[model samples]
Target: MSVDSDIISTLTQRAKQRPRRIILPEHGDERVLQAVCRLASNGAVVPVLLDAPTTDTATIPDNVEIFSRRSDAAQWRDRAAAELFARRAAKGTTAEQARASLDNPLLLAALLVGLGYVDGGVAGSVATTADVLRAGLHGVGLADDAHQVSSFFLMALADGRLLSYGDCGVIPDPDAEALADIAIATAAGHQRLTGAEPRVALLSFSTRGSAQHSKVDKVREAFDIVRRRQPSLRVDGELQFDAAFDPIVAQKKAPNSAVAGAANVFIFPDLDAGNIAYKITQRIGGAKALGPLLQGFARPWMDLSRGCSADDIADVAVIASLLGD
Candidate 1:
């Protein structure tokens, strides 16, 4: 079965109360706006385009709320200056410096959220990952259940089985314990996105001691830690991807394991394998990859790489809004 397209449409209809703020950072493009417009038309969010006034005005949608309205060279600029001065005096910022940080649109957006003008932010695509990550790490508090922020992708497979692969979007080269942390966060994300409790197999090249590798040893230890600490979860690993995914292969390779032969989540050994597998699956095999979806933050925040499409923005917005509610 396909994932519901109305995941966005329905969320849009029900999101009338306290709609989140989706801030478009500098050079955040048209395709991005098109996606925001879909959410706007459906009433799911307050879309505030961060900087639309300059030469790039033609790129934005005609009806979208833009920061352009605040700029007029003579009249509004002075008013902006005066307000900046007063606000600076009130907040102990120097007049010269009132405009310093705010000149950076990220600081502006952070001010908006901190002052409670909006619920959250969706950034990246046009902005750098460092830019978005800095804003989030410095802006939002950690969510109650999470100790540290992390990322995950809820892979909506073309075949009807769902899978999640992660920390690809964050936490590079995780240790055994950190991988266990990734597994737990990834499991929660799988449940949140697909309404499916994960049966996660920590994937690697070797299977059940048939071959030896340093990577395999790390995954094996991670599995034990995960099993002991999070007993409610169904997980096993150090299996190959095929074993993790194929019931027959899993049954034969890693016999009599509850997590084997019926796994829904596949945690990769490291960044290289996870990235390559998903990229190959998407570009070569044509799987529908929805996220390097950011999970475990206190507020719903997602990042868009420069390659993101209008639909990608829309999907992420839906997922972020779903998590917020």
Candidate 2:
């Protein structure tokens, strides 16, 4: 989800309209259950525990749906090899293909979603990054129109500012065009998660002609590409962190950038800055780090770190429900 208040409201509307029954991966832990419970009690979709052992049910909410993981391991899809090969391969599937797919945990989970055995897959607390992407990519697949499935983080400043920090958790160093695409996606995601019509600031050390180098030039070029891609969007770039977030600093530095100080969404030029900025804010600055939103998907799938609390699970569950089809 996004930090934009409007995006928050949008999720609220989704909770009211089409609540889902998300599928938890096999033997998924207690923390995850707690998260599911928080959202369900508050009118989000009911959680459907999948592949979880029977002994574990005692700790889960009584009303939540539970799918026997043991059964799904063999029953979700039969035409292929894995019982849960998603709806995408109901026909023309080979056992060898299914076997290879199941080798990937993400793919295995995605198969369940693909076959409609589950509404969505929420893993990551117990799997590797490779596992998460491989499954989601194979099972859910990308939107026919999208070229890639990148990631984003939903960050909220303690001072009541909310915005997205992106591709930090996914791509290491995106090219100018990839950066441009990420910006557009992040802005749209901001609207979806926070309901804010984004005024984006593409942040770098260099603000509008203040400096010129490969790094600065990248930000400048990406900004141009993003603007061309989405002319209706209000985005500008090559801005310093201060100029992007502090209006006074922006006026003094750039003098003419629409994004200076008026910005609500910031697009980082690279991973080093984006990842470092968010960590510092989350750790030292006392801000709430809501998400690595996992945007650019056809379905409402999200991930969790194994170290996360039950509260984290519940919040993300609500977010996934809010993004449902």
Candidate 3:
């Protein structure tokens, strides 16, 4: 098997060993139902459907549990609404607004995760990315140590290596501090998901002092912050993409750097660079991009691409289950 397949197989096996209860809010989507069936069959997760399937019920496995807000007891809904209000009260969310927000499957799914009803949630098939992330932020909130929420794509290259690309889906223009947070969070996530210590590279247009620009300075400052915050981490930066990925370029440009040319986790300067880079890697470089999976959240919640397939949903569900671990 290919290394990407092997990695996914291992992750699925690990998730099956101790299956998590995961919510799929977009039950109306055929792909979500198919993924539910796959998860049930594989024993990778206990797939919880947020509402009754709009399609034929037999397509859903018997192991799947349905939680319909319409059919559920009023007392429980009230409790959930209260919890939502409490969580969002600081955002000027009125009790009525919190109660109404529960009508949204995305928000409800996140609330379920936060209330410990499920281990995690996967949505965004039909919902926009902003709605999905807003639900997670409002309902589940951030990890205690996390200053902000960031995202990473686990790129499984055809060459049999796994790397992480960060801030690709969130944070349009991160300042130095936010960039540092993205690096730290993505590094931890890389270790947790891939079982490899992160060798992080803060990518830039310049290699060290080869060029000068405000953007380069931002990357360098972020690199310094990462080093200060995570002194033991193997990290280097203001590196060009080639210097970060190719040993030959590293030898020429940044020979003494600990993480040069061997970076398993790459932190981009902005969302434009990160998003574009991961797509190019996936399309042209023939890498499997496993995420834009969210990091820095207290619980695991995934945002799927609108174009994601059933297999993609299943893969992400398994990944989310493991992340909750």
The numbered model that scores best in TM-score is 3
All models, RMSD in angstroms: 6.0, 4.4, 2.1
Better of 1 and 2 by TM-score: 2
What's the residue-level lDDT of 48 in candidate 1? 69
lDDT of 2 by residue, 1-325 (tens): 4344444455556665777767666344666766666666776667776544545566666677655434444555453245433443667666676676665546666666656666666777787667777677767766554567777777776676676787667777888887887888888777777777998888887877878789888888898898787899988888888988888998899788777888877788777878898888778976667677676666767777778777666667767665556
Residue by residue across 1-325, what tens digits does model 3's lDDT show? 9756777898898888889999999999999988999999989999998777865987777778887644554665677799999987998999999899888888888988887888999999999999998999887888887888889999988987889999999899999999999999999889978889999999998999999999999999998998898999999999999999999989999999998888899999999999999999999998988888998889999999999999889999999998885
Clashes of each: 0, 17, 0
- Candidate 1 Cα errors over 4 Å, as ranges: 1-21, 26-28, 44-100, 110-117, 144-149
- Best-fitting candidate, measured by lDDT? 3
Q: Rate the local accuracy (lDDT) of all candidates.
A: 0.69, 0.71, 0.90
- lDDT for predicted candidate 1 compared with the true structure: 0.69
Candidate 3: residue 270 lDDT (0-100): 96
Sum up the clashes in candidate 1. Answer: 0
**Sequence-dependent TM-score of model 1:** 0.76
Whichever of 1 and 3 has more TM-score, that candidate is 3
